[model samples]
Target: MRGRTVVEFHGEIDIATTRQSDQHLDAATARSAPSVLVDLRGVTFIDSAGLGPVCRAWRRAVDRGGDLTLLCTDTRMLTILRLTGVTPAIAVTGS
Candidate 1:
């Protein structure tokens, strides 16, 4: 069976919710080389504090030889990722 997991996040993502977000990402990516999809379509806002978990999840998936895709259509969020150079390290799909 192909192991794939999807994590959906909503509302604003910041320091107040990083830990919770990280927990969700960690659980989904913990499986062996899982194909993880992070659905950020519901996220209305994100800051550097929020980006930390995304980066960490990406690194974890890469280190485990897995694949991770980010789903989002927020121009602001995309801009932030681009400005931070995180766009190069992760795969993002407009949703």
Candidate 2:
């Protein structure tokens, strides 16, 4: 919404899913000044592999003068992001 490309991720996000997630994220952040929103509310589990794509996407967005936001209401996910030092680099919102 709001002229942004919204990517929603569900279920477990681990090594197995990173490649696909990376592809989508890469596409979402390809254009200059692209605005992307990654919805992670449906995610139940995530690991370092999953976070790698997120961080890369954030970097790509910023490098292209764009921005990427994460939508996650799950406490566990939020905690993981925080502990992993990912929250500081990306904007996260919920509901």
Candidate that would win on lDDT: 2
In TM-score terms, which candidate is top? 2
Writing each residue's lDDT as its tens digit, candidate 1 over 1-95 gives 78678999999999999999999999988877878999998999888899899889988988898989999898988898889888868999985
Worst 10 residues of 2 by lDDT: 1-10
Which regions of candidate 1 fall more than 4 Å away from where they truly are? Answer: none
Clashes of each: 0, 0
lDDT by residue for model 2 over 1-95, one digit each (tens)? 23899999999999999999999999999998989999998899999998999999999999999999999998889999999999877989986
RMSD of each: 1.1, 1.6
Clashing pairs in 2: none
Looking at model 1, the pairs that clash are none
Error of 2 at 57 (Å): 0.5
